[model samples]
Target: MKLRNLPPLALAAAVGVALTACSPSEPEPEESAPESASPSAPPTSEAAPAAVLPTGEPQVLATGLDVPWSVAFLGETALISSRDDGDVLELLPDGGTRVIGTVDGVVHDGESGLLGLAVDDQGRLYAYSTGEDGNRIERYGFTGEPGSLALGTGETLLEGIPAASYHDGGRIAIGPDGMLYAATGDAGNPDDAQDLDSLGGKILRMTLDGAVPEDNPFAGSLVYSYGHRNPQGIAWAADGTMFAAEFGQNTWDELNIVEPGGNYGWPEVEGIAEEGDFIDPVQQWSPEEASPSGIAVVEGTVFIANLRGEVLRAVPVADPGTATEYYAGEFGRIRAVTASPGGDLWFTTSNTDGRGDPSGDDDRLVGVEVG
Candidate 1:
């Protein structure tokens, strides 16, 4: 069935970069203009956000990203990113990249492949990927060697997430309390979102090692919240409020305020409801305008990358309940977005990975200066 025709909950089920090895420090804040001011037009050249950088040249953080899917910074000098084609890259201090390893047998058909990535206080790297049977999460040691990990040695930290050629949930991040947080899709089964035990269409909170956390809202279960159709972006701003970006069934894709055990109105509700036991979106936009993916919260603004819109969107968060958007269209087919140590924003382009045509540079890691 087409997405637009899907039931209110059906759309809910559907659906980064750096290189520095430095000390862990607080994320630099992203700047925001007055909410009432109009957004500046996109730059004609490959330059960073002039608002963030008066010098105004978009810097190439890394290149040859190989269908880059997700990214997370390890420290100020080094960062890592994974590709949909199964490759993982490490960006070093020298501004060059090296292949750390390949996620073997990642089912790359449709939208399923190597997706979300995260790291813990212990420095172990975690990833969400399409396994042979379903989507899985695993962890590896940080050896600093490209394509040289003990690939077979990493344990499957979590397994049995529902997987379809499409709707496979892939975003993973470690929360402040040392718990792993993940956003899952509906696996094309609208009703699956309402089923707490199915592991599909839910936001899960688990241990860094994959055990269910005892304090989880659903006691003895990994489900932190239920009733999500397909959530693509997850982030925690300096204030620690968790926010998610989700693709809609057809009408409105959403940026949501996520809480433990919160029901986000998937399968039965989309953006907001006239009346329902579900949380509402802080920000909603047309699907064509923003097929939102990975999200990063710097200072108070949330930077959302778009696959369909092919631009980077900034949402200023004065209040948790509402925000406005700023569009910078310099990047085409942006798939992942993150923050850098030098007070800049980083993003990846996914044009050559099958969604659209390559524009000069098929896939590149670019940086945007922000407040």
Candidate 2:
């Protein structure tokens, strides 16, 4: 059955390298990736018989979001996070929205406002947002039912992640392993990306209780991988192949197949270097065309939301080297994309965030059926 756009539409819109291993305290910044890395896991490709992506136009689900940054669903109900105001919105059936509640202690800055959101199996809501101190992760009790959703008191899970107006990489998701994963930027300090002790410029993995995973690449540390500039997207395939999308300085943006304890070259290198020391990106695009952010993988296809590129890009899991573009310049500044609970693809726009030209309903939530 081909899913068509909702009939009663008010408005609609749509949408890393590794570090090398090195010696103890003397580990050089330019060292190649660690030796424990499994060979670069290739994306699921056409050869693997991946499903085709939907070409139909996106269907608008809701409108009037204030600089919305991320979206997560609890069962059938959708929860959206706003950056400027730190409001969590519940999407209504009539293409409208209502405020569930505002998150506490959110301090909005350039790109350092309320950002990523994730829901756990225990019905807990984990939020990654910027606080007065820095970027932090908090767990909130998700209470009440849908439509009447409310947030209970929060427990701080982690804090003091580096924050900057521009490079505050803030995106969180739960891996198939049921662990909480966060992508953090370099926080405007490139050297921090190479420091294993620094939380910036790396993908972090932690238990639900905020403890570092014992099996992490680094011992007694939450840093799963390091040497990233501004990684904003991370997703895993059914086979557990991890993929990440990152922003480059001025040359390139990257899509990488992540490896445990892998080191992706950051200030040392931008795109593919073919250097054995650092892991290379599976694909690279010019920054003007691919400031990629939040991404999702559905049915062996990796869906990416590009900010400046202003397009939704799809890459086959088996063939991550290439991508197909959709809705280019139709809806301004695509921000986040997620697999909807209804088996469709849901995405949100970011035009109202002091950038692109937004319509009356500039920041909107939209979706498309994918089967």
Candidate 3:
């Protein structure tokens, strides 16, 4: 389809500056400041300086995409996955899109369809999608370079993940340890979060070939952590610390530092309980202000994309207790965000995902530089 890209730096100079909220109350490490999480006062940390915030407005890289979900880089080239039709699109130099290939057997409705995409260091492409059988992850072989890209038949890596209209955790990433980590929701049943035998409500890890690693916490299993409600975002700090964002029922949402075999207290608790029964989130917020979806760690900062809150948030790694918000309500709903190969931050909007208001220029892929 024909899409348009505005001049790279045009938007920043042409439009007025966006409002940025860089509030850091406690400066303590967010992992230790769960007590500060509340609707009136979010965890505060000023470790991230104002200089790290994005400079100027985000420029539209490509517009007119239909319900785009995830972004992956095959070198400098950007590939986007469509959540509605399961098609993979490659961005051209001229700002248009070419269909690389369509994922077959993807069943779409509600929050299900083709959701996440990842490219391994060896050039293999991985995707997470929903099907009649359930949710599954498939690996595909890639041939050719940017602009002339091609995807071979998909090989199902793992299948039978619990799926539902909501809580179908679909984010997948290849960790620094070269293992595949996947986030799965409770699939509408909170009890499943406590069931070790079920894959739902846990972050599962395995080899690239889909076999459970011998060193996994549970013997002969893929469950990395348990007791999660609807975790959709996962990332890692440079020091090898793992972080995740989870959606709470109605009271609070969470950001947690993940540990192997750790229990995150979903049905038993929502936020910081000061109890030892389960792991508490480092920071928590009301669902009305945060529906944190996709997150990426960049240059010591964690950037998050929120669906219901309609903002792109930044959390400093040094003191996660603090947060800086950008583009609040300026763009409809942000679904995906990642660091581009060229060192810029790229994100997508979710207006066409049925939960947001869509404009003629909605569902765009935008790129911006983070100072």
- Give the TM-scores of the predictions, in the order they appear: 0.81, 0.89, 0.88
lDDT (10s digit) by residue, model 3, range 273-318: 7678898777777787789999988877888888898888887776
Model 1 spans > 4 angstroms off: 1-55, 77-80, 144-152, 320-328
| After superposition, candidate 3 runs with Cα above 4 Å error | 1-35, 38-51
Instruction: Give lDDT tens digits, candidate 2, residues 248-329.
Output: 9998898888898998988888888878879898888888887999999998788999999988888778767767777677
Query: Best-fitting candidate, measured by TM-score?
Result: 2
Candidate 3 overall Cα lDDT vs. reference? 0.81
Q: What is the lDDT of residue 275 in candidate 2?
A: 83
Question: Model 2 Cα displacement at 194 (Å)?
Answer: 0.5
On residues 227-298, what C-alpha lDDT tens digit does candidate 1 reach at each position? Answer: 888898898765567889888889778878788989888889887664458877776767887788898877
Better of 2 and 3 by TM-score: 2
Clashes of each: 27, 18, 5
**Candidate 1 or 2, higher TM-score?**
2
> Candidate 2, after superposition: displacement of residue 193 in Å?
0.6
| lDDT (Cα, 0-100) at 360 in candidate 3 | 73
- For model 2, the stretches where C-alpha displacement exceeds 4 angstroms are 1-49
Worst 10 residues of 1 by lDDT: 1-10
